[model samples]
Structure formats: structure tokens, C-alpha cells
Target: MNPRNRNILIAAIVVIVVVVAGIIGVTSHKKSSANSKTVNIGIMTSTKQDDAIWKVVSKTAKDKYGITLKFTHFTDYTQPNKALQNGSIDLDAFQHYAFLNEWNQANKTDLVSIGDTMISPIHIYSSKYKDVKDIPDNATVAVPNDASNESRALYVLKSAGLIKLDVSGDALATPKDVTENPKHLVIKELDAAQTARALDSVAASVVNFNYATAAKLPENQSIYAEPINKDSAQWINLIAAKKSEKNNKIYKEVVKAYETAATKKAIKEQYPTGGELPAWGLKLK
Candidate 1:
């Protein structure tokens, strides 16, 4: 073998090695970029406000972390968690801790909350009476038939001095726990979505903010609305995902976006009377 030919062969081998290494590097980088790209989120509804919030989050995610975000809104609460559990959604932001807990317990799923979003204050509205004291003895009060919100209604009634509950601490309380009914408030449990409409028939009703908002009955119009500082286990609305996805980068970014000043400002502006207070905490303690 001649010296020139040997040298050319060695140079050719080096070039080939470099080219292969470059190809491998490029492939790996592309895969990494693809994996770290857009995050798909599931929300309750695809309204204008939800789109606006998603835009803010998408911008933040892209600007801060070079990630894009997509939002998917479900019309019902049951499907979002089911979607999360089934790995259809990366995360969800429409439910409170109580609903999540109840679903988890009932379905034996491992969905967990990653961060707090905003508290949807429950309100007790009445047309026949101005306050709790005005209700006649044994007055029928309509409450959401759902477990969590029904429990919340009972707590509100207890708070209003209409009933005495046997439960202690800030855990979820049910109607069965009512030890004393000074007003003899007959709890006429109705579907949560229907509680707002029941206001016309019942003496008073405990209404969720969403239904209340839908009914055009803001919190200010209610006879009583839950206060901001009340941490009575019912106020902890949260951002949730499957347990396996809890610590993902996208989840953290979503949490950051949710906790941002802009998000809080939007919440206050959007739901001033509904008492949509912030809850930055995610983990249960």
C-alpha cells in the first residue's frame, strides 16, 4: 500500500465516522425536541375565557421553557378525570379537591392534584327570606344532591346557625352528621345542576358558582356566600393529573401559569362576587 493511498483511506474513515456521529446526534436532538414540545391540557369548557387563559399559559410555556400548549375542554367533570386516568389528557383544571377525592375513592383511581387553581365559593341563596334566621322552623332548603357539594351545603347551613353538625374539624360533613336543626331546615336534596332552579320552589338553596353563574345569580345576590379565608376543606379547587404525571415539566409550567399574577387577576375580574380565591397549594396534608 502506498503512503498517499493509506493517508487518503484514513482521512475517508475519519470523515465517515464524523458523519455517522452527526446523524445520530441530529436524530437524538429531534426526538428530544419532539418529546419536549407541546403540552395538551384538558379543561371543563372551551369558552372565551378558557381560551384566553390557555393563550397566556401557552405564551409563558413557550417563552420560559420553549414548550407549546394545547387546551381540551370537557363539558362534564366525570370525563376529564376519566380521561386523565385513561391517559387521554395530560392534566385538568376544572375540579376541586373534594370532587377529585370522591371520584378517586369511588372509582379506585390514582388521579392526584398537582396544584390549586381557584376556589369556587358556594352560596346559599334565598328568595323568601333575607337571612338564615328568617326561615320558618322546618323550612325546606334545597341542596345539591351530589356528595361533595351536598356536604358543602350542609356545612354552609351549619355555618349559618341553621343546623348543628356532630362532626369535628374541617373535614367534609354530610347531612347525616347534623346533630341539631334549630330551624328544622328540611334538606331537600336536589341535583347539583338543578339547585339553582330549585330556588323558585324551595325556601332556600345551596348553589355552586358555575350553576349560579349560569343562573345569572352572582354571589353578591346570594343571601350568603362563602368567605375567602374560609379553609373549611371545601375551598380547595385544584389542578389535577394522573399520579404518574404529577412531576412532569409541563405540569409544573401549568402550575406556574396558574399561580401567576395574571391568572389571579383574571380570576378576580371574572368572578369577583363568586369568591374565586386563589389556592396555590397542590399537595394534600
Candidate 2:
């Protein structure tokens, strides 16, 4: 063979080798990705209730995003964030922006919101009074004692025309912030879970929607509910991950799964009577 022909042959062999190598690399990448498809998420609610919404989300993630969602259930509000911080779970979806802020400030952790989920509105429920107007002076009104929730409950009271607050809408207001109580309302604070239970004893109690659902609080008993207005944006529920994973592609896909039409339908069905409103892309004004 001539030198020129020999050189051409070598060049052809090099081209075939590079093409074959590229195909193998692509196949290997797919396999590696498939192995990492399953992601574990932490939740602090009853699995039965969440399953209604997450069943749709999980199915969507699997079908459309090639991801599998597994849940790690915690019994209380405090555990999921701790679990996420410790790398025990890949994500958490049981908190609003205010609650997350409170937790992050207290724990000094850098968890950040990656997606909005829903607004679990807090309402003043009364077993005795037919309306907020009917509740007399010196009536005891129970509110959640937690920093964020206490502030939200006060805002709800202000909305009801039962009290006046001195703090800004976003401030973590307390009983001291109650600048005026025209009804001379007694602001009793209790655990968020116990607020619903307090309705029987107190004139009224500000109850988180989840606790109200768990307590089976009657719809008509809710005399006043906080508006889902611009100020309520901080109360919008969200999915949170570690700051390091805030921009993670798989995490973003999980958010996409939760924001689908099917998930919205499931949320409505699961939380009949508007206990939980889907908040993704909600234009609060």
C-alpha cells in the first residue's frame, strides 16, 4: 500500500473508534440517571390525607419526569426540617414561607423555598357564637402561640374588626401588638394543634386549616377566616430544600410534578371546603 493510502486507513479507523466511544458514553449516562431516579421527601402530615395529593404528584413525576417520589413521614412539625437539614430527606413540603423563616432563623439552617404548594388558611372558629359580632366583650379568643402563627392569628383578628394591631402586616405580631381591643377580647395563646380544641372552651379560636381538618371543625363554625390577599403571600405553603440543592434539576422537576393540573384536582378533592388552596402561580393582590 502507498503511504497516502496507509494514512487514510488510519484516519478511518480513528473516526470509527470515536463514534463507537460516543455511543457507549451516552448509554452509560442513561443507566446512571435511571439508578438515581428515586427521591425521598419528608412530610409531617397524615399519609392518608397527603396521599390524595401526592399520589397524583408522584405519578406525574414518574410518568413525565422519570422520577420516583418516596415519603418519610414525621409525626410533628419540627421533625421534617431537621430531617432535611441532616440529609435524611431530599425535600420537605409541609410549611409556609413564614413558618420556614421562623424555623431557619431559630435553627440557623439555610433551607430555601424551591416551589409554592398551597395556602392552608387560618380561621377563627366558634362553637357557641354564630358570628364574630355575637361574641361579647371580654370574650376569650385563642390563637396559636408560635411566633409566625401568633402574628397571623392577630392579623386575622384585625381583619374581623375585633381588634387593632400596631405592627406591620408582615411583622411577627403578638398580644402586645394589639393596640386596641374594642370588644376587650382576651387573647389567649395555645399550641397550634390545640387552638382547634380550644374552641369548645374559648369564645373563639384561630385554627390552622390542617388542625381544623384533623379536629373535624364544622365549616359554619368558622366565623372569620384570613383573606388570601397580598399580605397573605407569606402564608403560602412551599417545598423547601437545603440551600445547596435549591437549583437542583431533579428538585425542580419535583416542583413541576406538584404544580400539574392533576395535583390541583387532587388538592381540591382532598381538602374539600377550601381548607387548602393551591398557591403555585397564585396572583395575590
Candidate 3:
């Protein structure tokens, strides 16, 4: 072959090699992007109640977002938050805002709320009396020992006129803030999970709805239950994730599943009479 012809053939081969390399690079990039989009969600427990809700989330994620959900359940509250902070999980949905805020503030972590979930109303259950006023003056009452829940128990007591708190507006009231006790009620603080059992010992006890339900306490039998339409800031449960995952597509899909009509139907069928009200937003009405 002539020298010019040989040089042209060499150049054509180089151009072909460059085109093949570009196609391979584009294909690799597409696969990498797709792999990075799968979402890993962490829940607190695999309890029967939670499993019911998660089924909806899982189905919605597969059908709507074309994303696979890797669901994990922590046995306790601490591990899920730690896992989320360390990037082990992308999102978590087993705690209320009060618990999340308390944990984040104490640990100095940057967990944020992406959306609200359901509100499990804490009820004041009485074994000895028919109503709040029926309890004798100076009788003992049981409340949760944790800071956030303790404050909520105190507020419930204040609402029932068993104690008076120096709270302005709708602020949370604490034991130290108790301004007056016309009944001089003896307050016995116990672990939140243990409060339901304290009913046999104390005049009455403030119990979180989950524990109450687990203990088989009938919802209609409670002496006092939080109103579903109160719009109280303290009532909203949240979907929490690291600040980095706030706008993630899979995280948004989980929130959407939580607020779907199917979720509302599940909640209503499971908790008729507003025992566990849907709280996806601030306005309950």
C-alpha cells in the first residue's frame, strides 16, 4: 500500500476505538445512576402493627417509583437513629417528633423531619374511678418517667384539673412548672411502658396508646383520651432522615405512601373511633 493510504487506515482505527470507549462509558454511567437510586428504609420494629403499614409502603414503592425498598426493623429506638446518622439507613418512621427531637438534641445529630405520620393519642386510664373528678383529693397518679412524655403526662393532668401548671398559651408543662395542686395529688412517675401496669397500683395512669393497645385496654374504656381534632403541635409523628436524604426520591416515595388513601383506610379500619388518628399535617380538622 502507499504510505498515505497506510496512514489513513491507522487514523480510522483510532477513531473507531474512541467511539467504542465512549459507548462503554455511557452504559456504565447509566447503570451506576440506577444502582444509586435504590432506597433503604429502617423502621423501629417488625411488630404486627408496623408490618401492616410497611406492606403499603413497600407495594407503593415498587409500583409507583420502580424502587426497591430494603426494610429493617430495630428492636429499640436508639439503634435506628444511630443507623440513620451513620448512613446505614436512608429513612426511619417509628417515632414521634417529641422523641426524635429529644434524641437529636441530646446526641447533637442532624436528623430532620420530612413529613408527619400518625398520632397515637395518650390516654389517662383509671382503675379506681369513673371520671377525673371522681378521684379523691391527694390520691396518687402515675405518669411516664421520660422527659418528653413526662411533660405530656403533666399537661394531661393539668387539663383534667388534677394539677395546675404555670404554662402560657399552649406550651408543654413540666413537673417543675406545676404552679398549683388543688387536690395535692401525689404524682408517681414510671417508665412509659410500665405505666399501663401501674393502673392496678395507682389511682390512675397516663398511658401511651401503643402500650395501652398492647396491654389490651379497650379504647372506649379510657377515662380521658386526647381529642383527635385538637391540632396540637405535640401530636404529630414524623418521618425522620439525615439532612442529606431529605430530598431523596425514595424518601419522598415513603412519605407519599404514608399519606395515601390506602394508609388512611388501614388506620381507620384498625383504629376505629379515632384511637390512632391520621396526622400527616398540622391541621387535623
Could you say which candidate leads in lDDT?
2
- Model 2 sits at a Cα RMSD from the real structure of 5.3
Give per-residue CA lDDT, model 3, range 70-116, as digits (tens): 88778776798898899888887778767777887899998998988
Q: Give a tens-digit lDDT track for model 1, residues 197-243.
A: 98878889989877877788744448876655454545587778888
lDDT by residue (tens digit), candidate 2, 1-285:
999999999999999999999999999999898767888999885647577788889999999999999999888888999999999999998889999998988999999999999898788899999889999999999999999999889889998899888986456888988888998988998999899888778999999887888898889998988898876988998999999999999999999999988888998998787878889989888
lDDT of 1 at 232: 51
Evaluate model 2: give its lDDT: 0.89
Runs with alpha carbons beyond 4 Å of true place in candidate 3: 1-29, 32-36, 168-172, 229-231, 282-285
- The global C-alpha lDDT for each of the candidates, from Candidate 1 onward, is 0.77, 0.89, 0.79
Selected candidate, larger TM-score, 2 vs 3 = 2
Ten consecutive residues with minimal summed lDDT in candidate 1?
Answer: 276-285
After superposing candidate 2 on the true structure, give the runs of residues whose Cα lies further than 4 Å from its correct spot. 1-30, 33-35, 168-170
TM-scores of the models, in the order given:
0.84, 0.87, 0.85
Question: How do the candidates rank by lDDT, highest first?
Answer: 2, 3, 1
